[model samples]
Target: MTTTDLLNVRSLSFAYERRRIVDLWSERFDAGLVWLRGPNGVGKSTRLKLLAGALAPQYGSATLNGKVDLLTDPLAWRREVAWVSAEPPPFEHLSPAELFGFLAGLYPRADRARWELHIEGFGLAPFLRQPLRQLSTGTQHKAALAAALALGTTVLLLDEPLNALDEASLVHWRACMAQAAASPDRLMLVVSHEELGVTPTRELILKP
Candidate 1:
């Protein structure tokens, strides 16, 4: 991946309850798997959320391809970004199948075929009929991941992705990540305690 397809952040700062979480951080990440390595409470997930446009940073400017600015062109910027949270879905009624259908209608570039494949690849086909509350934590994460991966976005923010994956599902994800790492224009920031397999283009270690 080249610097032309970079995920660049400058003057990055964030605070919670008047306590500084991210303080004047600045980094340029080239397109590839970026291992977001840090100790717990270091704001790794918060940084991802900031980039995903879920949480606005107290200070900073971010750009994709040096063209799409997060602050100025947020709608266009969000089209190229996808976030996969480690936490299970908060809602209780919707199933993975229902979630996929809803997302397919929601996103303009939704890939229904890819979602079908992911459902089987993640071993979630059998649980498609089950409600979110009926599924296990791992299964819920799988559903969220499947939706995110199929969105065909350039920026993928994966928080603790390898957690709760079974042996076969883990293998599937490893292969998928390896393929993603080889992409020339895609950026993946994986927040994890363990390095699953693929090599990271860079390690972003955050300090509180």
Candidate 2:
């Protein structure tokens, strides 16, 4: 396996309060955009959380770069993988500019220049100085997305990425994902309910 074979989940099991969600799930993730599709109650979000190491697996293992464990190697795992959810963590008091500066410190190797480009492309400059709570839902979402895109991680896990964007922004974001996936060293796993016009390298459907 090469760098493209960065994420591997083997015999993974996850349960929520004794209710099994993912059982004995195993798969190898390769570079490129992989659309993770499934019906509403099939644990798509849960699976992404497991893969992102936001939630620990009840059993089995998830490996990053073929060696780093998602459970025991959190810090190392986060450095190479970026997770973006539909509703991002609250930053009500912080402006987009302020929030980006704060989060950028965590990823030392993140591309500041590219981050700026995302901000411009997403048309977030107008609201960049306003508090997040004051911005529209779509603007706030774009701010969060800008941070994730700026991270320059090897693996990107995006949940409902097209949630609140306007038509123009939607087109721009699709281009962004497409451009990022063009790199052979990067892997973008996205969970979307509708087609956003960008073609996925592959699609994996999880049936309940």
Candidate 3:
């Protein structure tokens, strides 16, 4: 493929209940925004999870930066990646401030100021100190988005990021995504059912 550092997946396969979801799939993800679009049950989320090293592949391998095998060097791969899932943070009892601090610890190089900036941009300041459970789904999603983006990782993975955003927030997040995509060194992988309001550099569409 292109002479760039790529997220390389080869002969990748996975299944649930003996039913195949992704079957011997292979692709290369390079820098800039790449939208993974597909209908429900097409394994878009599963592929994202596998790419983020959140789920172990049933077979085959995925490599990042040419040599970092996600299956073998998961922690190393994660160190350079940031993932935002469709679901909110699991620690509903934790406030956004606490959760952000925890994430900053994991990503020692995280930009806390940028995180706070996004928090404010997303109108999450009032909810920052509130427990995640007390925040609305959209607000909680904002918290996750802020933390993930603030990490400033090389690889950013998002699953259904636009699902719970308000119209204003959605526009703002789309701008943010565009800005992030402007960077040639950062790779953005997003799984969405609708247009993100920004053109993706590439797209991969799966099927049932």
User: Local distance difference test, per candidate?
Assistant: 0.84, 0.84, 0.85
Q: Which of the two, 2 or 3, has more lDDT? A: 3
Q: Per-residue CA lDDT of candidate 3, range 54-96, in tens?
A: 7777999887778788778878888888888898777789998
How well is each residue in 3-72 modelled by candidate 1, as lDDT tens digits?
Answer: 4647889888888879988788788888788888878998898888888898888888799988999989
lDDT of 1: 0.84
Name model 2 segments beyond 4 Å from true.
Answer: 1-4
What's the lDDT for candidate 2? 0.84
Worst 10 residues of 3 by lDDT: 1-10
Ranking by TM-score: 3, 2, 1
How much RMSD separates candidate 3 from the native structure? 1.6
* Model 2 agreement with the true structure over 4-80: per-residue lDDT tens digits: 36688888999999999999999998788888999998988888888877888989888877778877788888788
Q: Which stretches of candidate 3 lie over 4 Å from their true place?
A: none
Question: What would the TM-scores of all predictions be?
Answer: 0.92, 0.94, 0.94
lDDT (0-100) at residue 93 of candidate 3? 92
For residue 174, give model 2's deviation from the true position in Å: 1.0
